[model samples]
Target: MRLIFTLLLATSLSVTGNARIFYLAPGGSDNNAGTIASPWYSLNRAWSVVSAGDTIYLRGGTYAYTQQTFGYMVGKNGTSANRITIKNYPGETPVLSKGTGYTNNNEHWRGGCYLDGDYITIKGLHFAGYTQADNFVWSGLFINSSNNVIVELCQFYNNGGGLILEGASTNNLFLNCDAYNNRDPNTGYGNADGISMKFISAGSTNTVRGCRAWENSDDGFDFFDNNGYVLVENCWAWRNGFIPYTTSQGGNGEGFKLGSTNSFPSTVLRKLTNCIAFKNRQSGIHQQESQCLTQLYNNTVWDNGWDGVNFHYLNLPHTFINNLSFDNDIAQVQVSGNSTNTTNSAGTGTNDGGWTVNVTAADFITLDTTGISGARGADGSLPVINFLRLASGSDLVDAGTNVGIGFNGTAPDKGAFEAGGAAPPPANQPPVANAGTDRTITLPTNTVTLNGSGSD
Candidate 1:
């Protein structure tokens, strides 16, 4: 369904008379009036004369891109109040495809669905299969637009990377998007990622809220080399830096990697709250650059290969409040290089350098969240999962030092979940069950049988 969003962004966009609504469908003709009954044949035709305050609705269909001449939803500006919206029609999907033989030159050659516009809204779209090749060139969606753009309810999978919003991209909002299965075939310089919004312009910031990134070849969310502050809230990342789709070896993986590995550190601050990072190949959350200030609040992380949440290289102090870490291979907090860890809790003993609470996994209702994605509420907010919810009467509840945020009980909880925070109102969802019983399964046609691993 189309969302009723307010346009309160601050920017300069030309006043182009009044708003217009254009329509595009698979079977539309260029000669049509761009109306619902007679939509335009291509996005190029609809956006050719589109102005500020105009809205373009893409009808449900598979819009495939060609390498010979790629398609771009490019250079259509909209104002703050009356923004331009290019979105899928209500209750429909617009699947954008990078057709067979997707090459590496889309980043340089510009041969795919490219997004380069300001103050535009893109929603309820899926992109597929823009992979292979190296040099970190092409991606499913290339975004280098100006300001106040909103990318929502979009899915990018099996691509080189999901989206790259860089190069002076500012004040962009990414909400409820999922990026997975992005891989680089070139092992020499593998950097296939999910959605990276680094290198943002000075005095411009980007915010990612209610996003899910998982199972990409590289890091799930990369905000490296950014000069502006990046705020992330209520997001999740898991199984990154490995091919979750094909179960293959992925590139340099980290769940949420803040700052850059380059010589120069990021020149801005980063804030994260109510996020979860689990099951990633590398550290669940890591900051490469020591100079950048980081603020972490009410985050939950577990079962990662390295440290659940690490900031060992920090010489400058940071804010770490009410974050939780458990079941990671490395120590709860790595104490190195003038570190000052805060009152965060790790299941293991938290006595390294500045650790405080030694909260254990038993304090949580459940330790796993294999089925926690997209189960929040009708609006797709943070899920109230049995996985990692703080147990009643546990020391973690109300044991956290106050961070000026609201509390459900007497005080704030140590982790993301609060004891008395109400769950989402009831909704109509199909029942689901997961189990891992030892059994043999045989394909009916192939007559191939395999044994179960007896795990869930």
Candidate 2:
């Protein structure tokens, strides 16, 4: 009987030991047990007690901070099977704000949340009012050295910058997020971006999907000095590089700044697909000295202050397919790279090697810029709009080569959206393995790197 009791107890403990739910409220106390009714006060308290499979639900309210460096820091690790989740309570909103009096030294930076945890998920939180007038800048959510972290449905506004992932962060996903109105007065509205993924380690991959960035001081999305593969899909950026409601010039207002460094030797391939960038001060998509391979597919850019698509670099290898660029201040596509171009629509490009069709206002249902920055759907998807979708019988339909991504008609459509069909499933194929090339190792060498890019 004693053995039977021990066995049953062990089974029960094994089933329930790993997972626990903690609650955080703006008015709660840390001395409580973190229950739903008696919740903890701060994210710091939750971070101190959470383990793998543990969840911290933040109740609705303002969580203000005055710290010079980090308002709240998370340095925990969860497993692959069980992730640590810090999310808003269902049907409620949690806002994280920095104190108005927050000021640090001229050399120091500040962040509302510093997340360095692995395998964590943060969802449905709003980070706002994180501005500082000091010489340094601030980030709403700063993620560093973290792997497999997921940040979804978050909004960042009125801050120095938005979400920034850097320094060896790998495989992190930012989904259904919005970053706008982020300006840095210290640099004359420079050095602030909606999403900045910089200095990531090589051989790692990060994804940003279904996000929006607008009216930020700097670029909408800046991938500066990253050596990893970044996949950006279904995102939008507009009206950056200018102060809101004013003509004051902001920072370098490129919509998507795809990397800047030419020093890294890794095969860093950045891919952007199904994205829209418009009305920026600079080029919509600028490949700023990223000598690595970049793949741009099914993107749309219009009404930019400079070239719509700028890819002038040192004859770097790039791939542009089914892209549409029109109505910019300067040329449509500025290409100096040795890129594979196919079935694109551009006006006045320096290299018109791949120009196929001419896209005009007649090709779209509505050129009116209305409701582009409206509210998102309940499921946090992008706002459905007819701003740039291809009209019926437009030449852009079925005018693209198959690039492995799914298409609707006999071939893929030219721009970001297919003209007349539901979205298709991903390409179905057999599993193929690629172990890179054969390498000859010296006697003293202990290891060698293998290539997996050929694998699908």
Candidate 3:
């Protein structure tokens, strides 16, 4: 009995200790040595060898290619816990690309890490572009699968495209990523969107948090032909252009652009919170021909070339809450065409001749005493507005409706940030370490292990 029990326990331990690690160097080997000293030469080689629960570490160094065309076509799939992770080794950014001197006009030569598998985690790498014109053809990371994937703390610059999450990718997240400086030679336009969710059929919930999109030739974040729930919170976009325009279409260049062509069970529940948009040539947030419940709260829209918020063909049941607008050339909120009554509250508009509170139907605007003072109604009660901006020394200093959403335990100041109280500092920055020299593509004799020991 003792001998049999010992053998069974050993077998269980073997199964539990099956975590493997692969390393990728600037110039390395793909042999199954499983040592940082002996690493894989290419990303595809690592992908081929890693199992469902394996992690491939890319060591610090610019893994540049002499050839103009170098791309990684992934072939492996992973589960939720055993998902394959391609992350920085420990100390530096793993630069992944073909070569530097290549011109952008090579249409056939496409490159960048292409992902088709599910449950993948890519972190802490810099994806650089080949040529200015090539920015339209290549992408930093292309994701097609779904379920518990994370793309965090990556830098994508001058690429043909940023991150593309398509093909029913649900429960995926893009956190703390940056995309800028992508240019296209064909249209004299660039494809430098921070993130784009296109052609999604299923109802996926994708959240973009603490990301920055700037100076992209197109809109900062574009949701094209998608029918999914998207939440963009605490992100920044500046100096981008929309379609049909060239130079910095300005004013954060249409912070959020939504268009649903087919309208079959149209995209629903788009929310923007705690964001700031300023100094773009166009409106801060623009929606066109989409019947979705859009909500904008605790955001600051200022100094845009046009209106602060512009909408056309936007259906009813939209909520604009607690936003501050100032110094825009047009109205704070501009709505034309036939549309249902959207709620507006707790917003302050100033410095423009346009109405501080402008609406197609005046009866729909309601100011609530729960927020700071602004527009008064004939009944001597405050109309309930969607967004409320607190004036200096105003009673709204601590007066706000506790909606119990997105509150960070501060006193719930009247506006986005905790007034008089410090705004909660941005989330802790990701650990700074080199990502290039960390991953070595080597097959391990031992199986990969999955653990849930860390703090949740």
Name the candidate that leads on TM-score. 2
For candidate 2, which ten residues in a row score worst on lDDT?
A: 1-10
Give one digit per residue, the lDDT tens place, for model 3 in 273-382: 76756555566777645557666766666556676767545344455555555556665766533332222322345322232342211211222323322332322222
* Off by more than 4 A, model 3: 1-15, 31-34, 66-70, 100-110, 130-136, 242-252, 264-267, 336-396, 406-411, 420-456
Q: Which ten residues in a row have the lowest lDDT in candidate 3?
A: 1-10
User: Which digits, one per residue and each the tens of the lDDT, describe model 2 over residues 363-387?
Assistant: 8988787999898876678878798
Give each model's whole-structure lDDT.
0.73, 0.82, 0.59
The alpha-carbon lDDT assigned to residue 174 of candidate 2 equals 98
Q: Write down the TM-score of every candidate.
A: 0.83, 0.86, 0.72
Point out the higher-scoring one by lDDT: 1 or 2. 2
Q: Determine the backbone clash count of candidate 1.
A: 0
Which pairs of residues clash in candidate 2, taking residues 3 or more apart in a chain or in different chains? Answer: none
Question: Model 1, which residues run further than 4 Å from truth?
Answer: 1-17, 29-32, 67-70, 100-111, 133-135, 187-189, 246-248, 261-268, 335-340, 349-353, 427-456
